[model samples]
Target: MTILQTMVSVMLAAILTDNYVLSKFMGICPFLGVSKKLSSSLGMGAAVIFVMACAAAVTYPVYQLLVAFDLAYLQTVAFILIIALFVQLVEIVMRKLLPPLYKALGVYLPLITTNCAVLGVTLNNIDDGYSFGLSVWNAVCVGMGFTLSLIIFAGVRSKLENADIPETFKGIPATLIAASIVSLSFSAFSGMI
Candidate 1:
């Protein structure tokens, strides 16, 4: 396939067929935690997108350097450090510019530092042997997919607030059920590309 076709397929696969949260099941903590409110979800999603993209951009070159030095095994450490730096940048910006969102995100903001999804994207890019541009594009697409899942689940959770249900299935149990159903719906996108 041409470069354009490859990019498009990668985008679709990342955002739909292989969503990190809904499909691959990475980063479920922030997915379930900060998704309680639409505003918070959007804020967290944007932060994650920025961090993931930046991490990919930096990590790609860093990985190349590591490979050249025969220190490739240190990639996980290097990538995590890069991801943490961006997450800190995001945290400072959010705290200064949007205190409410900063407060809303709470521990989850710092938790982004350890988010496996962000780290996973960087590693996946290297493992898949994608070029620098494709690596960054894949990260953005994956972040979008993460955002889409959060927004949809937030809507569902809001509806659940008003729905009558058995006491046994209330709260976390109900949320899990909703998440699973949403995940199942995403399965339809599988093989579409």
Candidate 2:
């Protein structure tokens, strides 16, 4: 297939049937925590997107270099360092330019440094052996999927915030039930493409 065709397919799959957060179950912490509020979810999603994109760009070349030097086993360590540094850079920029968003994101901003979803996509790009352009596109798509899921969950939570629930399924239990329903809905997209 052509590069364009490949990228389009990757984007669709990543954002729909194979969403990192909902489908693959990576980065559930932020998915559940920041998703309590729409504003916080949006900010967290943007931060994750920036980190995922940069991590993909930087880690691909770094992994290639590691393989060249017969140090492939150290990729996990190298990727962690790369992702951590990139998250730090993003945190600094957000703090300066978007103070309110930075404040809202708060601990989640630093938490992205350890977010498995960021690391998962980076490693997934390398494992898939995608070209640089495809890797970047896949990363962006995964980030978008993450954002889409977060926003949808936040909307659900907002509505539930006002809804009356039985005592047994009040807080986290109710949220989990909602998340399960959402996840089941996403499965309908499995046959989409």
Candidate 3:
């Protein structure tokens, strides 16, 4: 495949078949927590996209440096520190410029620092042996996948608000069921690449 084909395939795989949230299930905490409202979900998704992309950009070279120093085992620790720094930067910027979104995200904004999906993208880039550009692209695509899942799930959850249901299936139970169905739907894309 050519470079363009490779990039497109990577983007499609990340945003569809191998979604971190819906398929790999890497970052479910914020996926479920902030998805209750469309507005909050969008805010959270944007923050995640920012952090994941920035983390990937920083971590790729940092990982190379670690490998050079024969400290590869410290990649996880180094990646986490880098991700945390970016998340903190995002938090500070959002808090100052977008107070409403900042308030909307609440504790979940901080949770981005610990989001495995962000870390996973950085680590997976190294594992997949992608060049710097591909790694960043993969991170952005993964973040888009995360956002897509959140938006779809948020829509599903919103519809559940007025749906009449058995008492046993209300609240969290209903949300889980809906999420499972949404996840199942994504399975159809498994071999599309």
Clashing pairs in 3: none
Question: Which is the leading candidate under TM-score?
Answer: 2
Q: What TM-score would each prediction reach against the true structure?
A: 0.90, 0.91, 0.91
TM-score of structure candidate 2: 0.91
TM-score preference between candidates 2 and 3, better one:
2
Write candidate 1's Cα lDDT for 1-193 as tens digits.
9999999999999999999999999989888888999988887888788778988999998998999999999998888888888778777888899888778664466878878899999999999999999999999999999999999999999999999989999889989999999999999999898
For model 3, the superposed segments whose C-alpha errors exceed 4 Å read 93-108
Candidate 1 residue-wise lDDT at 150: 95
Q: Residue 193 deviation, candidate 1, in Å?
A: 1.6
Give the lowest summed-lDDT range of ten residues in model 1.
101-110
- For 1-193, candidate 2 gives per-residue lDDT tens digits of 8877888889899999999988899999889888988888888888788778888999888988999999999998999988888888877888899889778665577879878999999998988998887888899999999999999999999999998999999999999999999999999999877
Best by lDDT: 1
What lDDT would each prediction earn against the true structure?
A: 0.90, 0.89, 0.89
The better candidate by lDDT, 1 or 2, is 1
**Model 1 misplaced stretches (Cα beyond 4 Å):** 90-108
